[model samples]
Target: PSTSLLVDSMVKKGLFDRKENPRDRRSLCIRLSEEGESRFQLLYNGMKKRLDSLFGILSDQDQEDFCRIVDTLYTHVYTK
Candidate 1:
């Protein structure tokens, strides 16, 4: 997989801005554009709202327990 190719495609799509690094001309600095940030926020909020609604169906205790279990699993999987 070519990461640079993917980045170039994203730049072409206007989702990312690529700038030359001041200290290293060979390196390019990439960041999400304003339009990309706006789109990402919209998608994040929509997913969060859907998850909140889905979790709303559970009781408070169940939700707490579910969160605890998820946290435990995350810790187990992510910790070195």
Candidate 2:
């Protein structure tokens, strides 16, 4: 699907606010609405809880190693 379609859908659902950018009237500034922020927090908390539960079984050193590996992968993927 096109990005415009996705943005339109979100706006229709009241999850996003789309407005003309102040600095560039030709462009738009899209941001999450209050409802979107609330939903995002709920989802983030749920995922964090699940991850914490799953990782709780790991030893401290194993957890550290996992974090290090994740950071390395994130850096490699994002820096490229």
Candidate 3:
């Protein structure tokens, strides 16, 4: 129910749409709006470009090691 309220708020804020669920009349499907999609694309592209530039500064082997360390750190923290 709290998620539903959040979804409604997001829709009202123009980030997404609240559509009736086809299989369930009582349920609604939440989807990102066009503006939200554009915003997300911009964010994704910016992050990817930045990451690519950062990785480009490292040697291939260094990048591989960094990825492994990040993976381990993620697992260590998330598994806790």
TM-score for candidate 1, please give it.
0.87
lDDT of 1 by residue, 1-80 (tens): 59999999999999999999999999989999998898899999999999999999999999999999999999999996
Clashes of 3: 0
In terms of lDDT, model 3 sits at 0.91
RMSD, one per candidate, in order? 1.5, 2.1, 1.8
Error of model 3, residue 14, in angstroms: 1.7
By lDDT, the best candidate is 2
The digit string of per-residue lDDT tens for model 2 on 16-72 reads 999999899899999999999999999999999999999999999999999999999
- Model 2 CA deviation exceeding 4 Å by range: 72-80
lDDT of 3 at 80: 86
Which residue pairs in candidate 3 have backbone atoms (N, alpha carbon, C) closer than 3 angstroms, thus clashing? none
TM-score of each candidate structure, all chains considered together: 0.87, 0.84, 0.81
What order do you get sorting by TM-score, best first? 1, 2, 3
Candidate number with greatest TM-score: 1
**Clashing pairs counted in every model:** 0, 0, 0
